[model samples]
Target: MKKSILAIAVIVTLAFTSCTDDNNPSTPKSTFELKIDDLKGDITDGTVTLDPSQTYTLTGALIVKSGATLTIPAGTTIKTSTTALNTSLYIGVERGATININGEANNPVVMTSGQAAPKESDWGGLVICGDAKVNTGDNGTSEVGGLSFGGNNNADSSGKINFLRIEYTGAKFSSDKEFNGVSFFGVGSGTEVSNIYAFESGDDGIEFFGGAVNASNLVIVNAYDDSLDFADGYQGTITNVYISGVSKAGIEGSNNQGNDIATPMTDAKLINVSIVKGADAKFTAGEQAINFKEGGGKQTYTNLFVSGIDTFAKLDTGSGATARIDAGDFKVNGKNFVSTSNLTTDYVSTETGAGNGATLPTWATKISKNN
Candidate 1:
């Protein structure tokens, strides 16, 4: 009887399964638990709402094209195949598309690997592309998907993502193009992003490339590379972030790769950040907690707490970065800009208090206990 019931469920899944590259009504719409298998296409101009009570499998790239939306309710679980080749299993929302993840603090949406003992690089992670401002060009190609992004609108809206957890992701597309836990490419200020957690990512936990989207209440644990990375003329604000057990820098910032003096230079402000390296951390010989390289950007750090790291801040001398430090363009610890030579001696292993009255969110308290 049990075998018969399982067989019936498999038949129902196959009967309703539909896979296509273009927009059409032939796609499956099932209210019951749906098993998406080997789906190698796009969801164009349509909507896919996952049931919170059911579990879904993603075996290939699930691209939400223009005018499409993918909605995940609270307490939803979406697992990606670990055996997929060449970073196949991932989610990509293109320009004009939206992904509404309405997860609550107690019932957050979870996206993880399908393997039993999941390790790093199990699958590709989430990718969001928007038509916001970027120094790369009008329509620059993204590093992971080669999708076109970037425009003149600084207020472009991709959608909302809240109370989400991504685990064991960051599959490499190529030697130089590896996916982050969450990649925001040219995303804008109109989008709402908060309460995100990335765990055990093979690459960076979160990366913003040429975007103006502000984020808050972020947590990263056991990241193989930098926990947070900002590049390509990003002009966003980050608040209340915590990073632990990072192999590389806790925060890595850079301007445009091609043109160092690009318009809207990477001017990001970080508040109430804490980077703690555990006893068994995997840091390199000369790794720092904050590293700014390939400059022509302005960075402001306030009320930061960094401990158990070899170096606190490492600012590259090229690209006039040292000049920016002297000109008060980069502020540290609520003080005027100063030299980077004393950053380690001044800030490393120090217990700097929180920013003003900043406090960690409730969700962060629950997640930090596990790390």
Candidate 2:
């Protein structure tokens, strides 16, 4: 007689099973339990907390499926190893899932490469997907993980990220499909993100895709692309940002390109920011301090201080962008050090913002942990 498959469930210590998320009840994913020294896989249920004393290495993709939470204690370090072409080696939280990175000011959580000579694009980076609204198609899919994101819940909570530093991230899988140092896909304002640092990313330091999450105290260093980017009808409020050594624009804001008249256009409001044009001339065409294109929506920058290079604002030659700007929908408001000229009338000479001029902000002082 053949043994029944149900009989093996009671005797198995580590059982492999399929799980369905509440967000998308039809989609199924393989689930597994994470063990020390090997912290990667689909967490399907409950909350798993990492021991700060033990060492953890991410060898593959760690997906926190819906209805699960992954908690990293303060002073925890998660070293990662990845193949040159495999961008799937990342930590991602799906819709209805949560990841709590609890790092302190002095003892922060570090996520970096484990190679002897680590370089840029060594591995993929952190990705959080929530059910927040987006102007994309019915659902937006991520390039790195192929996960479906976007919904109508603007108050959805993905979780909290605090005092964490991620280094050597932003792996590229294709010409257009690449990873940001930190990517928030349709995340909501209920999530708490603060004191995060991005160092030496191959793409943008941090990116938000049609989310309402409010992020604060962010620092990006040596970003290969734009330091900060938001598109697809994102309505988020970011505060206290410091960027340096960027090969592209300091900030890039846009909306839905396919459907420029989509509901709830992108609204970007930032305060106390400093963007310094670095010496990385590898991309000479990347000479825009702030670039608004593709149906650019309302953007307000307050107490902004920019040093090195000129070109305060540059608008792309998109039909939707031009129409939006002409209609005052892409109006720039706020007091800043540089004069945007025709872009904004609210310009003032600002010596420094975010409590420090072009230097690293005090809130992002935990960047030392990743180095």
Deviation in angstroms for 281 in model 2?
4.2
Give one digit per residue, the lDDT tens place, for model 2 in 1-371. Answer: 23666567544633332233345454233345667777778898777888899778888889998888888999898888644344857899998898999988878888888778887788899999999999885488876787778899889899899989898998898768898899999998899999888888999999999989999999888888888999998998899998888687888888877876676789888888887776667643264778886777767777777766465677767777777666665544332222256433123225476658777766667655334
* C-alpha RMSD by candidate, in order: 10.1, 7.9
How far out, in Å, is residue 195 in model 2? 0.9
Q: Count the backbone clashes (under 3 Å) in each candidate.
A: 0, 0
Candidates in order have lDDT scores of: 0.79, 0.79
Give each model a TM-score. Answer: 0.85, 0.85
Clashing pairs in 1: none
